[model samples]
Target: MASSLATLIVSSSFFVSFILVLQLSSFPSCRADVGTAASYSAPYLPSACYGREATEFPSSNLFAAAGDGIWDNGAACGRQYLVRCISAAQPRTCIPDQSIQIKIVDYAPTATTLVLSDKAFGSLANTSAALINIEFQQV
Candidate 1:
């Protein structure tokens, strides 16, 4: 019985490890895969003061949530980046020369995606889009 129990435990451990590997493989690789962004409104961020770390939300009306990997221990917090719409999925649009300056206020720890506030997103892309491909550089 002890031998049988040991075998069962070993099998379970192997199965769990295999599953973890499969799950991680399905996640997007961290690289310059062309970042994307989605807009969030006041409803998603109820408080204007709700940010990773800021004495008070800035009055510029521009802010975003850095992606999980890019957040980098809050190194991006309060940092301004210039974001521009590069391209969009069909049935959507991308305006050349469309750009906006945004400050990082939250974390988006989910690969190559930035979560922008409605005001910030709207400044560059169509407000109705669920997502938009973008290129950003620290400014």
Candidate 2:
């Protein structure tokens, strides 16, 4: 009788331990499923940064010449930058016009306007060398 009682207790303890382990293991999957469902419901929320609405950017009087430290006309400027459109009337001039921060690396100079490097242009506008009026704030 004593041996049987000990065996029963051991068996019950083992079953309880196994059940606890299984419950704990399932917790992570349940949490993950909830997170995935939430993400699927609002897919655009994560990309909201890339789709800011159009807003008027205030113009600054300071205009740097090409090759100057500030403007550099695409020569001396840093390989990366953030450009914000200050002009309200010329909103579409900056494609992806929604208030976006862009990085600039290369230079393309045209008749009336100077263009940012390809990488920089990609941040703000999808088109390359397209004329767009923008004011840049160095990051």
Best by lDDT: 1
lDDT of 2 by residue, 1-139 (tens): 9999999999999999999999989785322100000001112111211232212111221112122233354443333334544332334534444433433322223232334334344444434324445554444
lDDT of 1 by residue, 1-139 (tens): 9999999999999999999999989984543336888877764343323633344466777888888756877787777877888887755566669777888777766765688888888887777787888987776
Query: Which is the leading candidate under TM-score?
Result: 1
Give the deviation of candidate 2 from the true structure as CA RMSD. 19.2
TM-score quality measure for candidate 2: 0.29
For each candidate, what TM-score against the reference? 0.63, 0.29
Task: Compute the lDDT of residue 81 as modeled in candidate 2.
Answer: 34
Kindly report which residue stretches of model 1 are placed more than 4 angstroms away from their true locations once superposed: 1-33, 43-55
